[model samples]
Target: MPKQIEDQKKILLRVRKISGQVQAIERALIEQKNCDAILQQICAARGAMNGLMHELLEVHLKDTLVVNQSSEQERSEELQNISKILKSYLK
Candidate 1:
């Protein structure tokens, strides 16, 4: 597990890079670049965004909803629910 501040910094950096990739994609389209190349760029951007979303959700689960369960039973249940959500998202 990462420290909260470090995780935030990583997320922010990814978001910034994604923004740049989006701008590149826009320029590629406006310039009428090759369709396959443009599609590849778009796919890269989409994957980056997906990764960021996954990281953010994981951090949110760790920091918020699953933070205060002191009992083993409660923690186990929370983890199960979290796993289900993650599976759905990844799928």
Candidate 2:
């Protein structure tokens, strides 16, 4: 299996729960559930996706960038790039 899938297995429970929550949200919509409640679920799912992205980005920064940085200048440049990425992503 790919490394991402392998890594996901370790966190399978959270992923599974997120999937279930999405399914529930879909059902709620079909059943004409409260708009506020459906929106709350949508917000929760968005937060969950963001959490997953942050985890993957953290691993990439540590395992790839940290390993390859051989000089203070290189490391500083990487940090600057990462900061820029974060700013763009947040925007």
TM-score for every candidate vs. truth? 0.69, 0.62
lDDT of 1 by residue, 44-78 (tens): 99999999978887786776556654678776777
Best candidate (score: TM-score): 1
- In model 1, pairs of residues that clash are none
**Tens-digit per-residue lDDT, 5-66, candidate 2:** 65657456557878988998999999999999999999998888787768767765765566
**lDDT, candidate 1, at 23:** 98
> For residue 89, what is the lDDT in candidate 1?
79
What lDDT does candidate 2 reach at residue 62?
65
CA lDDT of every candidate:
0.84, 0.76
Q: List pairs with backbone clashes in candidate 2.
A: none
Q: Candidate 2, which ten residues in sequence have the lowest lDDT sum?
A: 1-10
Residue 37 lDDT, candidate 2, scale 0-100: 100
Query: Which numbered prediction scores highest in lDDT against the true structure?
Result: 1
Error of 1 at 2 (Å): 11
